[model samples]
Target: MTTAKTFSATSVQASNAATPYFSQPIIITSLEQNIWQQLEQEIVRSLQRLHCSRLQDSTLLLLHKIITNLVKTMHRHAFQRAIEDDLNLDISDKDSIFTELLQNELSMHGDRNIRKFCRANNFQITLIFPEEKDTLIQIEYPTSCNNSAYLDNKLAKAIGFILVKQTHDPSSSYSRAKVVKNTAIQSFRPEQAGYSQLLTQTEELDKAQAIFSQLNHGIVVFSSVGDILAISPAILTLLKLETALPSVHTFTNIIPDHFYNDVLWGLALESQEGLFENYRTRIRLPHNNNLSILFNISGYRHSDTTIHTIWQVVSLDHKATDTLAEGSILNEARVHNITRNYIPQLVEEKAREVVRLGGHTLPNEECQLAILFCDIAGFTTYVENNEQEESVIHTLNLILGKITKAVKKHGGIIDKFMGDCVMALFKEPHKSVLAALEIHKHSYDFNSLRMRASRDLLLLRIGIHWGKVIIGNVGAAGRMDWTTIGDVVNTASRLEKNCYPGAILVSEELYAMVTHAHATDISFSQPFYLKLKGKRNEQMARYVQTEDEPFLHDTVAHSARQHLKTD
Candidate 1:
């Protein structure tokens, strides 16, 4: 295209009538892109020509020293008029983006001449108005793709400031044009800009949305302002929500409480600080509150140049879900109050706190509980022999702490720690039996290590019973203890008091219940009836034993670490 100073055209009527078109965002669909593009382009040309005409009078003798800015900026994608900015001289796409983008993007110095480099179009547009010395405007348009001379603005302006790319690949032959006109009142209909050369990028955005909807992956696009602009259909399907989405989308409305922190981190940056990458998180479903999915988070600049965060959810197999008891209140209660991840002592503490906060007493209720009472065999005599107080405390804490961990590991909660003794409760008889086996095995290892260290070897006497107990918080609200108080507790304590060292004794009722257990893992002595303290009739009980340690894995979950003392 010809530079403003050298280029000339025949005088033609330049109308300023704004009848059909004023500067407004046109609401045309992408299918009607041609008309939209023409209107916007004509508006930009008319406005810029008016600016250049103003400069012609203002810079009559000022020459090159009087450079004027391009006053009207428009963004056209293929054949679609996308957006407009009459104040800044930036092009809307990558082809003619401000050359300053190559430098530190934060440093915007505009002392240099206008320049553009289109890598794909294989051309450059340079507008240089040298100092008062040159006093001339020079524009060069070069296409090395073809062996033709680079067209100066004098010839390129006549050709409507457009160049066709000569590429072997048809798809790569996309054409681009930019016109900075200074006509002497000559205005004819301009050549076809990019109507047939390439489709408007709105079509590409439409295709992207279509593909996003069809894919199984969920997509959440957040605007730079953190409001959700669009969401893929898959997000609704994956989150188990209705296919129809709400009008006002936001992270606060969609993301669950557990995962809000992750999205907050993404939005905090807003593509200005840095690129946001995959931040894995759990996403709870809106419609099905019970279900949730693991999502991977990321962010990018959309076609509108707005930052958007995407949450790509990974659908897991049924086996990866929380627990088998889908809607059971009991199971959910256990998760909140008595999860195995905590110490056995802490589980009941948290459970009681939950109940106390509700402003209701834990009413004593009769329920079947697997009560386990265990004590260090000959612990009193061992203490008499070893009178070093600090040594005793250290040894007791080391061993007792390990035993307490085993109780929690087997899904039982510690009811009390009775100096060298432990009383625990379990919902299933099998778990109490497993805990006894674990304690028995641990005792053997403890004695072995003690023997090697020349210390008195210790033994474990454990008793397990399955029967009804009144379980609840005992004492007033200010000071209370969560415990079981019934005949079942006494029977279990008596069983432990009667048991011999290095053995586990179980009541006949516990043995009968465990007989139906899946692979009981415990062998029992022949059933025997014993007349015990306070028992009107004979009490049936068995001496429980395990031949092997049962080669169990260390942790129940994926995250537990192998502790030196507990493992």
Candidate 2:
């Protein structure tokens, strides 16, 4: 019979500032001592790839201490749980029971223990359990663990441990593991030779393919000569291809002639200087001149000769159609007239104004701008109940037309129009408030006319807020828009969404601005403090109305005159 090797339970001093191992000498029965020796032999054999001969005596002692403590602690926990469960486990099943318990505990706390040990020893270590196939419990000392490499290596070293070289800090005198080109453990049975390496290569390929299939952006791997080696599924979806391309395809075969040269230039520049350049271009699909895909291309050098080109779909626009239905109130023709023609002209004028003021960008200087959001209340229900599409379009346009006119008249710019809402920007808070009042008064008159005609009354809710905003071009290339992006816009939209119909809600900031400007004639209801959605604290707001009756009449008359002129 073979006699098990005996390990001394003497405590060892930590190599660094870590706590010393085992404060007290651990006492164990003869049977448990044999079990502990068996566990130690297994762990030592698993880590034999690290070359035990070159390790210092201190490192060997430390490894023994770690193994001894681990076995002892795991044995205690497993027995404790067994006692709690009232399990009468047999002596013959002890090895299997211990193996099961070790797997469970390692899955839960293996990485944590490795982290604590590495910090104490000032080294990096990765452990793998034979039972837990393709799993690694890794801890990186003095650095962040590379999860990707850990995952890949876990599949490679399915049955053994890994030890990384320690940090090259000059102050430390401890001997560290020497760096090796292939850190993967090579200790395995004769029958299992090369099995782990083959499995690792297969797993890596499968993982890469899985990732490419799930990504929203398209990836194209090209050789040094620009031959397409691989392409992701998203490329086919974006280009609207019915079938996958042949394996032997080139970049010029798929890329349009207009953008092929630009892509080539960008790829060459990136490959030469190792700099990533994002090129945005439009691709018109075959037989679809109106539909175009906007792509933002970037490159990643995989090697000295291979480049991975990434294509991200920024925007898909159909020039022949609009966001709304063809016969809706905000139809294709009207939307095109406003967005394509009017908004661009307004943006150009604003750009020119900035240039005249010796500024390179429009509205680059942060200044106070008032945002107003107005929308028709219960508009969705109205659309659902109304069957006459023509009548609905006519009525909806009338209401939106009046709101647009009021905004323009008050020195405001029509930012954008939603289905039943209009967002506007004003240089002055008072002007935005005035526009809100005029919109409310116009809605009142529209409701009066609808009541006489037995049509559903239209009610409007408006919100006004003033804050420092930076206006600039926002959107992907080939389709950019001048817009204001800040918390003020969100707050204004939220206020409009929450306010009662036929009411104009002004934020406390905008109210203060109006009062500071000495616009005392604007009447406001009692301030209401309420919590708005997405806001951390309660906010103060009030419903605003116009106290000047003559001002209201004059604006109404001017609006009627404008309507008559249009007729």
Candidate 3:
């Protein structure tokens, strides 16, 4: 290619004969002519290197204008139609075009020329002209490519002009093209751009709804605006209503007498400083005219936007569940409460709550309780020795009175008194442990008196453990007794059998909660694993001291030392 200085500015657009084909004027300086010649050579080399067919359509139109403008500016010729037919043109896919450009030997030569010119003349050249149907030129090369340096200076200048033009009209054709390019790039990205999280959240919500639909009980969802958004079929049935109620029902229609306003609405106003439970409320039933149903209400605030309140309807009747055995010791009040009334009352109340709140409330599990057991050691021997019936009866009654009194002082319930043993219950381990200690103290006090009278004093053994036990009536319909049964009660009875005369044994489970007592020289025995008479499994047992000295294990001396040091 020749240098642009070979042509002057006045020589531009010497293509007047080709007027209709080229309406635009081609303005050029002598230096511009040199650049145009090099550009023309580059374009021709690109087509030859790619082995392309002639261009057509919009692309053909753009190519023609480029070639015509270059020829007019460089050769200063008023070219005819014959001149246009002499030039070569090419068309191809972008991939083939890129491959051809890379394979071109001319581009390698251009690299050498570029470096030399940059070193000697300090002349950096650039190409900034529009493609077909495009108003602004773009930087189509990757920055890290070896060939990109050739166009860097030109691209920088073109971009600067484009940015300045865009400031005036952001929606212009040039800006619109940039926007479209950005949008296409975002759309074609391998990963999701923005909506993936939303889609995942929607799917999770759908799964949760499906799970909720399968539940046996009713469900009601409330929004911040006091609107009842949804009610499940179980909830509708609970209220004795049709399942197909409209979705737009509010809380006012379901709950009676400002129920939502007092409960959730009032709760919402609070900043939620603490959690509370068993807040009670009553709901009016559909069929019952004389009585309103009761519910045990409790709620937790999930977040600022959601408050989940569970309302469990309380059974008006106190019926015993079916686990009760037949022909056992019975309590008439307990039996009447179980068979005649409780279960139906529970169902009705639940139905009322469902109708009022649009869902049934969850029930709370039975609370933690303590088990207390005391047995008279050598009871059979005492009865055997005191062969006289009156003497045996008198000794048994005396021992029972002393043990039962101590149990009552520590808030224990006397479940029953066997020939020589008395079984009781405590609500807390501290109370129960303390009571067991007191029972042993009283046993010693009574035995000492009997020692003064020259009689064999009664020896008592005590056991205690803490756990959950169902405290209700159990047995057949006509006969039932108020009692408790669970691992807690059984474990305590096992520990009682393991104890010796005047011994008080407790379970390790209870010891954890009553560690404070042991710290005060009230050492316990090393945990013993033993099988009970009736049970197949081995259970763990520990002996607690009612006195001020360590009475049990020598193996726990190291632990005792540590406890002493910590004290």
Candidate 4:
């Protein structure tokens, strides 16, 4: 009766070679002080107990190969580097030893002609010991082959397990292992024969944790109920707390009255559709007033039904934005290395800045980047005097979502949103102008759709300009931001404020770039010079004609013009 429990050596061979090897019931301590002795004894006993095949030497060789391979594999970790001081071993020789052990063990298995091929190359085993605190053993072999013996994941894992078990270090215990071929080396604690050195493991983990803690970004771990669980050092600094949120503290207690309804409560319902949803929002902190915060939220399932979450809270100060921009360049670099993607050439320079300064800093550049600013005409009065809260948010979302898609399609980057207004930019002038024109064209259709549905949609006005400016990341460590600065960005904002509802205005600087690309219907509506705030000179601005545009149907145009006149 070939029951599952009554397994033979042949069955063992098939099982051991499978992915995720290591099926024996042997305890780790069994090989603590003596790995080879323990492994040799176990294999002989297992073969005798099975008593199924006459292939005793083959079984014994397989067992030795697996154990030796594991030992060689585990000896090559960075965490184990400190252990070499005791054996006075060189890194290259250490790797060579493992390579030999893996090949030797596999050659003994005889599934391939590796043993005969290795002998033809005049390869021989040699035992060498490094002079130091602990004894080291290695089997040397020549490395000149295209053998299939060195390419098996299952065999590698099995050998790694054996090596780790034999060299037990309470402080340096490895939760993982790897297997090498032919060469094998094992080291143990000087005074304690069974226990390996574990001090390095503990220190590495502490270092990693310290690095995370030193980051200026706020980190918070939340339970299934959205209650704060663990808080990082940065979060504590933001909260002005030496400890976690107080016993009496709740979400509402610390959240601002203005943003609480719109952000916190708003996300809980929307996030069930997907995990790790990010929200760029504003929050009033205890000490920092009117601070912009980016709430990066992600969820993890704790049980079958319960889900826990983590929130990375970061400030949106201008300095922080700059740092973020610099970090983006580095992020782009990491992507480039892994995927061979072509990032903007600026990324390498940004990485160099990080390398020089020990962190990312802003860049200084002069380029003709276009800027667009916009607002919904008459939205404040409508919100303040007539519309419901839910309706206002829903209407704003619909309008913004459409505009956002247009900007993205045209390669425009959104800067910031001021209530109903949006600020967007483009490194390329023609694209920015076209994107703004599209936004103006779509506003009319959106208004019509709302009117037909018996909803009141607000009119939109936009302003755009293009000129040289400084673009880079700026801000403190962890609280950095990505944005532009200079008179050009400010001038664009001023032009936007001068616009009326249903109107699209473009400064001459931007219009010149797109004059060749757009159709003949595009012309000036009102030619006027507008006084701007910061600049000493009066800026000349002209309105683009919204009449008979292809994107604006006759009926919609009439309604928009009527709406514009009535206001």
Taking the tens digit of each residue's C-alpha lDDT, what string does model 2 give over 328-418? 1223456767766456434766665444433454432233679999999889999988856448888888988999899889998888888
- What local lDDT score does residue 23 receive in model 2, on the 0 to 100 scale? 24
Cα lDDT tens digits, model 4, 7-111, are 111123333335633333322111112223333444443434434234334433444443334433432232133225535655453476745744564446321
| Number of the predicted model whose TM-score against the real structure is largest | 2
Candidate 4: list runs displaced more than 4 Å.
1-359, 473-478, 516-521, 547-567
88-120 per-residue lDDT for model 3 (tens digits): 333322356534642462234422322333223
TM-score of each: 0.36, 0.37, 0.34, 0.36
User: RMSD of candidate 4 to the true fold?
Assistant: 26.3
User: Clash number for every model?
Assistant: 4, 0, 12, 31
Best by lDDT: 2
What lDDT tens digits, residue by residue, belong to model 1 across residues 158-259? 423322223334443322222333333354433657434454799889988887666555566665555666777666656555556562352347665433
lDDT of 1: 0.53
Q: Point out the higher-scoring one by lDDT: 1 or 3.
A: 1
Q: Model 1 Cα displacement at 319 (Å)?
A: 49
